[model samples]
Target: MSVSINKITVLGSGVMGHGIAQVSAMAGYNVTLRDIEQSFLDKAMEKIRWSLNKLVEKQKLSQQDADKIFARITPVVDLKTALKGADLLIEAVPEDMNLKKKVYAEVDSFAEDKTLYASNTSTLPITDMAALTSRPERFIGLHFFNPPQLMPLVEVIPGAKSNAGMVDMAMDYCKKVGKQPVLCKKDVPGFIVNRVFIPLVHEAVYCMERDNASMTQIDSAVKFRMSFPMGIFELADYTGLDVIHKATVEMHMRDAKVIFPHPKIKQLFDEKNLGQKTGKGFYEYKGDKYERVNLTEQEAATYNPIKLLAVAANNAAWLITNGVCDRAELEKALKLGMGLKKELFATMQEFGPQNVVKTLQELAAKYGQFYQPDPYLVSYRA
Candidate 1:
């Protein structure tokens, strides 16, 4: 059966929630931005208005169109009212299974029998959450990147029991909202982007600790040599070290062999020096606003950026051989999700598969088995 979603009910009015609601409305869907308190909803509305105004000022959106889009998003504090006539319910609440189960129960009691359920969880397994609902087949994962209003990538993940039609509908829904959807065939921890991304960032930390490489040089090499939008350490600061620590710990818990929880990251997370939000992490920021890290071309000479990209390539290879996603989708995920200037596989090809594998092997010997080259990567022709 084909699934059609026209009305979206978004639970939680925090950053991700409001962004998702704003984009859905921009895509012409009637959206209900809901929160437990009116104040939360009010704040979300203000943020939405501010974002729309920015688009208008930049001429990306007309004032008339922005007003129309804002009008389409109805802010509500009541759960039942928000769920009323919603074709899809996107749960963007805090990442707690217990809290999510309670919300699902409430949604089950009020939502229409036909309403499809989607979780915007970045770390949790979709299958486990799907099991909490009566309609596990209707439960799917739509992991949007931070600031969904601007980020184009969305991981469309399906639980073990998710209906095939519903998965397709989720992908279509992403495209409708101006997102490039990548299917994470299995409900693996971290899905596609995080699965590959977490380890690459860890390698940066490893380089800093073991190789005694300066953070500025490492980031400079990554941005200048690899054409990455930001340096790995710089990205950690932008994303918040606490957030990386949490994600690393969570992913490591599920797959200990693949993910290593760096002591430095944990220490920062423990200390609450979260990143730009806290005015410090890998680098310092003033007034809680982001400032681009100053890196010179000469600094890029100190490090070989392939060391980090090799980690991502190996992880991408594992995902391919394990049937999580194919090569094309993996490349697309890295490019759009991570904002890489070049395709990851293309870069791997430039390094040559044999050399990439050799680097991983060398890293594995130096580090732990986590850097061990996967069989797929070893046998890769290109």
Candidate 2:
């Protein structure tokens, strides 16, 4: 039961949409990128051209091949024309559910019945949107990280009512576009990465505000001790403190116990200092581009990375035990999505699950029930 997706219609021309279109065109799929305005479409094309040129410069693709790939993308503003003949519709519109529902309604009327639908939503449940569409079984979530062209990980999530074979086909589509796909068996808020990652960021802030740890020390602990490629604060700033705050709020709305909006991030966001983009966040930046903050090895010893990892371990336990994903997929999601060199479960085991449980108990005492150790992590304690 394979759905042949030779022609792709990507609805939106923002960062994620343009990147999806570029990747699809690169994969030899004829792509139609539709937006509300011609200007948006033009800008997407310009970005695609720049990205394609960079690949050509690096010898990843020949100039001729790049040109052909660029030629394969058709940008339009007409809903009927854009949806016409599309075998797969990847919605990359804004994160608002209302806007998404509106787009889905339009697509339902315009798109072919055989066309499969996938949303690029990072947090929203696929099942909710799928139910609204004419074809619930064909709808799934294909979540791509920021800068989808470069990022390798794509979460292939199936709704509760999504067809089993379509889920498999979606995984194949991700591979066809040169991405590593991980299945998120359940469609919970934040899915896998955000489910765990958001709480980690919140705890890092908690360490700073509540524990009186400096951003430098917390970041040092994360990078040097935890072996994550980016420090917690650095990653937040790179992603924008405002963005993090919004995601935290959204996740909290779904599950108030485990996630909440942090005041520190909200303050930074309110100040209009949106990390690298605005040149100030937890730490200051000089320009529009990202520059790594310098921290000495001695600073890493000032804060324990285990405090951060404890929060992650608890969430990982819940995710695994609830069957959201297996140990392997959760590990891969953290590795590929979050860019961690170390395996999380392996690291937790090495650190001693009892120690993790102890840390979680401490955090729960101080921070409320959010840090309460899951039974799964506690089981390993004995």
Candidate 3:
């Protein structure tokens, strides 16, 4: 069964919503971008125009095509007008669940019964959001990373009651929009990327704050040893420490057992010195470029990128044990969404799950339960 998503209604004209609308328009869909105010829509359109123009300048698309794509997007301030005739409605509002649920309620009232619903929530569970809508089965999760036009990966998550066909349709729609879709298999806090990535970065922050390692050592070790495109701190800075902190805080709310960033991270967030955006983070992003180099065989062997990986793998194990996703899907989400370059499971295999468990055990013993291996993992290792 396929849903005809020829017309798309995207709520919120913020960064993610505008980019999603642009991608939908570019994919030849009639896109209605609705925000509370016309000014927001205007600013979003200007940003989209600049983004589209970049594609034209690079010769990725003809100017005519760009114009046509821009022409397909209709910005509206009225909610009912935007929701009318929209076959698919994507709620891309703020990360707050109440705000998202309110939008879902409004859209649900206005949207047609056949209108498939999806949330662009990164961490919030789809099941909780789906409960607000009239059509739970039609509701799913279509999580797009920041800069939807540039990032290729979209997580296709099915809520507890989401229809199988809707999940498949969401996946197909993702491909139609020039995105590579990965099935989340189930809905959980942070889904896949945030589930693992958040804890990984939090550990990096803790590692630095506890004087376990310097920021430079942490960055160099991961970049040189793990073959990551961005070091944890550098990526946090690039992603905005505030954003990372918010994700951690929200997740920590869900699971208090999860280790959060150190007080220093909160201090930086409080200071509004949020990484690249504010021009300073772990490393000042002051027109400086990172030069990553590969380590020698012996250096690579000794370079233990173990701590963060242990946190990630523990989360992975938790998700797997809960039947949220199997090993294959979790690994795929981590590799593609996090840009690990190498296969995650294969890397875990090389490291030995037993060893990962041991590392987690040692870390937990030294610090606390956050480092403790997932119960499933500890058993698996045994």
Candidate 4:
């Protein structure tokens, strides 16, 4: 049977849920946002109205267009009522496995037989979530970034039992919602972005803990030298160190191969330095004012943003060489999904794979196992 996502039912009415509903509605899909309570639903609707008005003010959308989009989104407190005619159901609930499984089981009973079930989970294994449904073949992970209405990337993760047709339908739906879709062949922990990013972010924390760099210097080096949108420490402060700490522990429990636990993360969480949400973290935020922690010049230079970036690029290269994904798709995902520059890889390739492998090996010998060259890189040398 062919599947067409003309009507989308989005479960949960939090930031991600409301944003997803907005994008789907803007793309001409009728969206029903389901929440457990009227108060929650009202708050989501209010946020949606504010978001649309902001878009109009920015000139990115017309007031008339925003109204049409807002009109297409119907808020409901009942799941069955909201999902009655949905062609596709997207769950943007909290990333607790039990909660997700419970919701999926309910959705399995309430949604249409042909409805495609997708999760916006960033870390949990999609295969595990698919097991909750009778029709595992229809389950897929459609991981949209924060502010789903604005972020361009949507990872299409296929669980082990997911139907090939379902994958195609999910990809088509992502494009329909005006997103660039990248397929993940297996349900790896953290999918793609978080798998690579979490480690890099953790190492940044390690750099701080060891007195290798101060928060400001470390962040400045990455932002200015590597052109990263923000320094890792700054991003952690904005994203909340506690949140990253929880995600790191969850991911570590799932896959112990990568030891991403950092003392800084644990200390911050223990001390209740939860970033902007809690008023302090790597940096302090007091109302509208911000203050960065100090660092020495030598500590700043020791972090080496270029070398760290090269490690990431090397890892990506190994993934591409091993057929995890094609070069173009990997490049596209890193560029569009992570907001990284494409030229990083192009420059490495220009320097040659052999040179890159040697550089990685030297770093591995010095920095520990994390920088060890993958077999693909070793094979390139052979």
Write model 3 residue lDDT over 1-382, tens digit each, in one string.
Answer: 6767799999999989999999999999999999999999999999999999999999999999999999999999999999899898888998888788678777877787778888998878788888988888888999999889888889989989998899889989999999988888877778788887777877887766665666667776666566666778777877778778788788777777755556767888998898887877766665546423222444434446777767877888888888877877776777778788876656667678888888888888898877878877787631
lDDT of 4: 0.77
Ranking by TM-score: 2, 1, 3, 4
**Window of ten residues with lowest summed lDDT in model 2:** 257-266
C-alpha lDDT of all candidate models, in order: 0.88, 0.88, 0.82, 0.77
Ten-residue stretch with the least lDDT total in model 4: 291-300
State the displacement of the C-alpha of residue 17, model 1, in Å, after optimal TM-score superposition: 0.5
TM-score of each: 0.96, 0.97, 0.91, 0.89
Scored by Cα lDDT, where does model 3 land?
0.82
- Show pairs that collide, candidate 1: none
RMSD of 1: 1.4
Stretches of candidate 4 off by over 4 Å are 209-211, 288-303, 347-368, 379-382
